[model samples]
Target chain A: MKRIVQILDSYSYGDGMGNHAGALLNALKARGVDTQIYAKYVDPRLSHMGKNVAEYVPSQEDVILYHLGAGSELNRKVTEYPGRLIINYHNITPPEFFADYNPALEANCRAGYEDVKFLADKVEMAISVSAYNSSELARMGYTCPLHQAPIVMDFSDYTKAPDAATVEKYSDGVSNIVFVGRICPNKKHEDLMLDFYYYTKYFNPNSRLILVGNYRGFEGYYLKLKKYAKKLGLTNVVFTGHIKFSQILAYYHTADLFLCESEHEGFCIPLVEAMHFGVPIVAYDSSAIGETLGTGGVLLREKNPRLTASVMDQILRDESLRKTILEQQKENLKRFDSKAVADRYMEFLLGD
Target chain B: MNYETYAPVLEKAKAALAKKNIPETAVSFCDVRMPAWMGKAFWFVSGVKRKMKRRLGK
Candidate 1:
């Protein structure tokens, strides 16, 4: 029997890439193919998740699926390895996005961009989570066949009720606007606050902006966003640094709107999660976001807080519109169902 | 959550930005002493940047 091997730069708890990798491992195993996950670094918390890359031995029958996102040094070997290669491109933040703020990540991102070009010849098939990223490979001059799929999400965990404590804490009559993603440069944290400012100034004063993501290395940008919000005279803006999934679901449970002002996203998983939780979304159509949304939520070309505020008010006050958005979002959520996506991936993994 | 704390600090940041434009540079670092996982790509990027800089100087 052939083995399905996975490679990633790093794995951590609650990471989107790690989630996809973990889910993919299970999918391959269910098909009775042996699977092994190798990573440059694994979070101590998820020690059993994957082993060090040094321990990974490439066999002729082994198909290695490499998840590319961050600027990790371990990826070069993924191409040099003598086996079938699958390039799973999770779009990297353009290095320019971090040029002004974070030099280290900017360098890493530049390397990631450069690394993809070298894979043009080695990869058997390149799969992008979104078509926008597929087009990028085309532009890079990769001649290999390419495929696209949304991130495989386990909605079972989402359907279960969120933590009641989190739900009750924020359920106190305040309209909560939530964005779940890392506090990174491209997320446009400043822009989210601008929209929040307009939403509160015109629509509802008791509203809150809840950001749920870890801001460990992004402390500078995070602090900058905090100061920018202060400059705008906005309050009720809470950055929940990092919290458990149940708590995240609680924020979603109490959230009135799921809003994204991210300037770049290969595919935003949080938007789908919000839809699963029945929160209506209003997102800026950046890169593959519109395609990811796929008739689920309102897509805006530009960030106009005033107009977005009006849309939120319209969605909230008009029962018909609210119901319509949620209904469409629910209909759209079927595309990302774990079993369905895993089946699609099986075809490629099995070379059927 | 205090909205006021950001105002004065942001003004200072704006003032700093007004002084000079930021430079554009390629990412490059390669040393064996650094974590073994840094791999050859880290130094490869550095080599490419050096060549570009040398060519531009000519």
Candidate 2:
């Protein structure tokens, strides 16, 4: 049997990346390949690097698969190992997108890109999560064989009865708008809040904005956002810090509109989740948002708060347009299910 | 037991050790020159300090 090992800094089964990795591993195993995930950590949060480093040397029979290029320990192993290396490029943000765009972060990300580029050259093959990321690798001069492996979402739960009571509880008799993912600078929660503040003021005063994710890592940015919301008199906004995956769908179902103004993404999994729930999305046309949203959702011009708010207002006010989007979302969402994504990934990994 | 199952568990243990607040000199005293299994652990702990320092903007 062919042996395959996946290397990651962290592996949370509840996370989008973790689910993607887990599904791929299962698919590989189903094809009669002996596959195991070798990571530093295996929880719902944080990267899984430190946990597995002590005993993870590759054997002659193993093909090592590296996920994400952020950790030095993994980098060192890749440099020392002489096995077949296959890297799955998730989200590799250019240094210029960082807070201060500091030279240090730039240099570090550049070094990461160099390591990934080197591994890409030596590896049997490389797979990116989106075409946007593949183009990013190509621009950085990585000439290895590349293919897109979109993230997967299992939407069987959405077909169940709509928990109207649970949805109404979160909705609070107003239009519920939700923004998922980490409350970090890159996710652009602050920009979304600013737009949301204005969106409620002029368009619908009863609408509530919900920001969900961990706040510990981005305290400074999170504080700034809270202060901005206070200054704008948008106290009705809710900040839900880290929710369970099962509860996430309730929020998606309850939400009248979903907004993603992120500056970068490998593949916005939340957008896919929202689409699966038939929620209309108004996202900035950048990175993988355009590719994921396709023609089913509204695309905002730039990341301007006014433009985003304007688009949100338009979506909320029009009932016919909202119904049309929901109908289209139901149709477009089939392309991102886990089985389809897993099949594509298996074909890439096993097909000659 | 196949090496695949044991490899990840061993690596995770090394990574956990690296995150501890132990002194560098004391950490260095640990044997890092065992067979492939133990050698992997030592390399992980020794390199973690360097990795943390770099991420700290040091």
Best by TM-score: 1
Tens-digit lDDT track for model 2 on A248-330?
66787788889988988878888888887778887787888777777667765455555456557656776876786777677
Which stretches of candidate 1 lie above 4 Å from their native place? Answer: A159-161, B1-58
Docking quality tier of candidate 1?
incorrect
* Model 2 bad stretches (over 4 Å): A44-53, A96-111, A156-168, B1-58
Best by DockQ: 1
* Per-residue lDDT of candidate 1, residues A149-221 (tens digit): 7788866777777889888889899888899998887888777887777678766798899988876556666
DockQ of each: 0.02, 0.01
State TM-scores per candidate.
0.84, 0.76
DockQ of 2: 0.01
